[model samples]
Target: MTNKPAQATLLPDNIAALTAYSSAKSEKISGNTWLNANESPYTKEACIEIRALNRYPDPQPQVVIDAYSTYASVDSDQVIMTRGADEGIELLVRTYCEPAKDRISLFLPTYGMYKVTADTHNVQINSLSQDLLLNGEVKDIINAVSGSKLVFICNPNNPTGAVTSVEKIAELTKSLANKAIVVVDEAYIEFSESYSCALLIKDFDNLVVLRTLSKAFALAGLRTGFMLGAKNTLAPVRKVIAPYPVSTVVAQIAANALCSDAITQMRRQVVILNKAKATLIDWLEQSPAVSKILSGEGNFVTLQLKDKALLTLATNTGLIMRPFKLYNQDNWLRISIGNEQELKSVKDWLNAISAQV
Candidate 1:
C-alpha cells in the first residue's frame, strides 16, 4: 500500500500557499549592530517578583489589565490582554469571522500580520490599494470595504508609516456602522501626534483598537499587547482566549512599566526616536540613492531606493534593515530608528558608500 504525499494529504491548501511572517530576528545573524526590528534599544531591569511560576497565572491578571486600561485610557472591562498584538489579531478573526465565509478588508503596504492572521483562519481577504486609504477618503473606503465583515486599519501604518487622522477614522467607522467591525491598530501610534481611536470606542460600539507594549514601551520580549473595545464587542474574544493569557512575570513587568515614572521615561524615549527618525528622513531625502521616502509616523522610515546595492552595503557593514520583498514592494527598505550612535553609524556607512560611487 503506497502512502499518500504529506503536502497533498495533510496540509490545508490555504496554509500551503501561506508564507509565514519573517520577523527581523528570523535572520539569525549574530552581530554587535541590531536595528532590523523596531524595538527599543534600551531595556530596564525586570526586578520581577512573581508569587508563582510553577502554578498557572491568573486567567485574567487584574493588575496587568488595569495597567493597560489606565495607560490606554479605557476601563478594564474594555481591555483584553493577548500574547502580543499579533495574537489579538488572531483572536479577532477566530471570534468574529467564520472560516471561508466572513471576509476581512485592509489596505496594501500595511502590516503583514493582518493579512497573515486572516489567511490562517481561511477567511477571505479583500485587499484595497493604499491610494484610497492614504488619501483619507471615507467614501472610497466605504466602497472598498463594502462586503467585508472586519475592517483593519493600521494607524501610523507599518512599512509606509502613513497615519490616518483620528477624525477620518471616526468618519469611516461611523459610516460603516453595523456593516463591519472597525479595528484600528495603534501599534506605532505612540510615535505619532495623532490621537488614538480608543477614544472613539464609546461613540462607535463596533470600534476595536489593538495596541502593543513592544514598540514604545520597550517590552517586546514580554510579548504584551492589548485589545480594547466595548464589553459586548469584546465578549466573543474573551470567550475564546487562552486560559492564562499572560504569565505572572510578564504581568509584573508590564504593571511596572505602566507606572507614572516608566511612562514618562517611555515618552522621553519616543522623543529621541522621533528625532532620529526625522534626521534619517532628512538625510534620506537629500541622498541621490533614494528615489522616494514614504511618509510615516512610526519609529521607522521606509524609502524606495535607487537599487538593492545600498541594502548590500548596509548588510556588509553589519547593519541590518528590513527589505519589503515579501510585501511585494521590491527595492523598498524600512530602517528602524535606533540609538543616536547606531543612527550615526548607519548614516556614515551610507555616506561612505555614496562616496565610493
Candidate 2:
C-alpha cells in the first residue's frame, strides 16, 4: 500500500513472452489423418443423451471424478477436472506459482505449457539442459530453482516423447522435497510399459501428476483433463481454482468411456500405432534429410534432423508438426501416430522428398 506503482494484472510484465497456443487449422492436416495432438482417432462412441448438453455439467461431477480416480487408482478427493490437461497446467500455476517471485522449472524439451503457464503467472522457468534421458541434470535442476518452488516433468514427454525411467523420476522427487513441487505429467503413460505416477501420489505430497482423456478416449472436442495430488497439496491450490472448469458433455462422454469397451479398442489402436511408429523410424533413419528419431514413451514420435532447415522445408507445404526451437531443440520435429492411411500420407510425401534430395 506504500508508493509502489499500480500493477497491470496479476501476472508479471515478462509474461508477455508467452504466446497463445494455436492448434493446426491448416488444410493439409484436415485431408490427412489427425494425430498431432496425441488424441484417440476414435470419437466418443457413446450414445449422446440430448438432455446431457441441455443441463450444466456437474461442477464437481461425482461420477466422473470417481471414474477417473478409480481408473488412475487414486482417491476421489485427490482429483480435479479442467477443460483439458492444458487447463490443468494453468490451474496449478495460478494456484501455486507466484509470478516474479516463486518460479517453476522443468526439463528442457519437455511440455511447453509448464513454462508458458508459469510465464503467464510471471513465474520464471529454469530448465536443465540434458539430452534424451534426464540422468545428468539433477544438479542443473537443483541450480535452476535456487529460489523456485515447482519442478515439472512431462513423462513420456511431448516433442521429445521420452519417459524418464521411474528410477530417475523417483530419485528426483525424493531429492526435491522442501525445495520445490515436483509435477510429473504422465499424459502419455497409457502408451508406456511402466506404471503410472498416480499410484505414488499418496507417498509424496509434493508430487502432482497430470493425465488426459483427450488422447486415449479420442475425445479432443470434449476437452477433459485432470491432475492427481495429495489432498493436503490440493487445499491451497484449490482456493484459486475456477468454479466450473469442466463441461457436462465432456464429463458424460469421458465417464462413459471409462467403463465402455473403449479400453480394448484403445489397446488395439495402440498396437497398430506402435508398429507404425517403428516403421516410420526405420524409414526416416534411411533418409539423408533426417538425422535421428528421439525416443518417446507416448503415442507420437519426434525426429531430430541434422538441421531445422529440413523441418522448415517440410512445413511450408502445410504439413504441420510441433517445432522445438524455443527449447533449444531447433533440429527436432514431433509427429503423432495417426491411422495407417495418414501414416502413408506422411511417409509417402517424405519419401518423395527423399528421392528429389
Best by lDDT: 1
lDDT, each prediction:
0.86, 0.72
| TM-score per model over all chains | 0.95, 0.86
* True-structure lDDT of candidate 2: 0.72
TM-score top scorer = 1
Clashes of each: 1, 3
**What local lDDT score does residue 235 receive in model 1, on the 0 to 100 scale?**
93
lDDT of 1 at 13: 88
Model 1, stretches more than 4 Å misplaced?
Answer: 6-8, 326-329
How many clashes would you count in candidate 1? 1
* Residues forming the 10-long window of minimal summed lDDT in candidate 2: 24-33
Question: Could you give candidate 1's per-residue lDDT for residues 1-357 as a string of tens digits?
Answer: 999797678899889888888789877775567777998887888898855888998877898888888888889999998898999999999998999899999888788888889889999999887778878478978988998989999887887777878898899889998899999999998987456898898888889999999999998899989999999999988889988888888888888999999999999999988888889988988787888888678888888877777778788778888877624657888888899888887798679666754
